[model samples]
Target: MEQDLPPVLSLDIGGTKLAAGVVTGDGRIHGWQVTPTRREEGPRQVLARLFDLGRKAVADAGEPEVAAVGISCGGPLDTATGVLGCPPHLPGWIDVPVGALAAEAFGVPSALENDATAAALGEFRYGAGRGTRTMLYLTVSTGVGGGSVIGGRLHRGAAGNGGELGHVMVRPGGRRCTCGRHGCLEAYASGTAIAERAREALATGRPSSLAAVGNPTAEDVSRAVESGDGLAREIWDETTWALGTAITDLVNVFEPELVVLGGGVTRSGALLLDPVAVAVARDAMPPAARTARIVLAELGAGVCVVGAGAVAHDLLSGKTPGKTPHA
Candidate 1:
């Protein structure tokens, strides 16, 4: 199908899954594909599978050819260099030149972006943050990740990882964070953290619905909360508290018009959004709280793909430096 904007191939790499799609200018995705990441296979093997998935998406998209390739993954990756550093989620994946590889494989230039940063752009351009001048986005999944759009521009931060909103300290000396901090928001609010807290509670002989499952996930905890499980509620409440505390700080600092939450954990819907919104409303600085509305992301799963495609579109349109090729 002919598109107003040239279609681009976009890929999202997560520790647990890899997704690819052809994204058009309207932020719509065609030929979406997803598969288990199986990180144990290591970077080289996993990337081979990811590239294969991209090819499948392209074929399914039925486009004559992709204009460019865009990649989204966890940081600390160097977007300028397209190198994947050691992300906690994908342990041992270090210094891999993902962009160059994609460029070579597809015979087109490629751009790499931090996954959360791309999602922020996606939300700002076409999702929940559309029509908003300033926005904050957080994806609370395997780990907490964040990005922001300030003054209608994507903020890449000084290091190019964008703002590490997830690293905002929520508790001084509480749970250990993957970044080695005592109590960052990710330590308390990530899906991994929620599951860990629930499992720990069950280990202490606490009576709860989660105890029935040998290994409960964040989704399991959310389900338990829906059924009025006390232990699950406790974990969910703490998760919301950490998120609210951190977001309150961000709202005070950025004063964004909207804060959009996405990722797998957000599948809990109002069970997660209502409390966080209430806490931010009740606790954030008055002016900032009044302007900021907490909302769920409109692009449920293909956000990063569309965001990366947007970046590719920008590169092609000369909005970004064309270090990469359009064809």
Candidate 2:
């Protein structure tokens, strides 16, 4: 039995940041909460604090009422059962029943999702991919992860982990990725990968203007690229090239109406988007290339919260997953 459910509480658990908010059905965040994750605290301590953050969001929303809770965390997670199974981002956390825990805390139903998958849902419901029957969302942050909506439904695939789009091979024998794969898209184009390339160039005595930061981030590399630094341009070009190659494969396979790119690396803006878009347009199959529009995610940093809220909304509204929920 359910009364009109209250506003949904959405939580995003990231390696660097913890974001929680009360989200309404209209794709707006009511009371947003954010803090550093302090990941070394381990899943137990961090999760406790994360839960506390959720409470604060609910209180701040002043709604007296959040009908359900939605959690978006980095995967390898069990979206169907709401269990987080040994997420690489949350080292040592094995099969934690996060959804059930949230349900207990809030006295309401809870849903858990992969952060990338949640981001895709957010895009589908409210962002660049809105109204599209098929779309893809890729987040190129500390690690690259992506989710797809095919035939108007989130394609969970046979492995429940959604498709690991980031694992697509680009260079075949290039950089090693977190997933222990060489030449995966994540190895070449993620924000972490960009910084790594910059550091490697510096280590090899390549002349560049990026020596000042001691430990430059991806943004630093972008700044250097814009400043006409040869080394930086090399690294940036590699990043964009890898993105272009991988997205081309994706556009060909999924034939999505839109491909939404988000995450830290996307801050490079058109430097990244233009090349990837151009490559996809030139390399993908004509039908898919013609139909797909590569674009940046409109929700920005708030996507996880909104996406999780969307998940909870669907659950509360009885929109359970099936062969194709959106269809």
RMSD of each: 2.3, 4.0
Q: Model 2: which ten-residue window has the lowest total lDDT?
A: 318-327
Clash pairs, candidate 1, are none
Give the C-alpha lDDT of model 1.
0.90
Give the per-residue Cα lDDT of candidate 2 at 57: 93
Write one digit per residue (lDDT tens) for candidate 1, span 1-327: 124788999999987889999998888899999999999999889999999999999999998899988899989988788888888789888798888888888888788889999998998998998899999999998889989999988888889899988999999999999899999999999999999999899999989988888899999999999999999999999999999999999999999999999989999999999999999999999999999999999988888998888877766765543235335
Top candidate by lDDT: 1
lDDT of 2 by residue, 63-150 (tens): 7988788899988888777888998887778898888778877778888888898888888887888789989999998888989988
Lowest-lDDT window of 10 residues in candidate 1? 318-327
Task: Give the residue spans of candidate 2 off by over 4 A.
Answer: 1-6, 321-327
The per-model lDDT (C-alpha) reads: 0.90, 0.86
**Model 2: per-residue Cα lDDT at residue 55:** 92
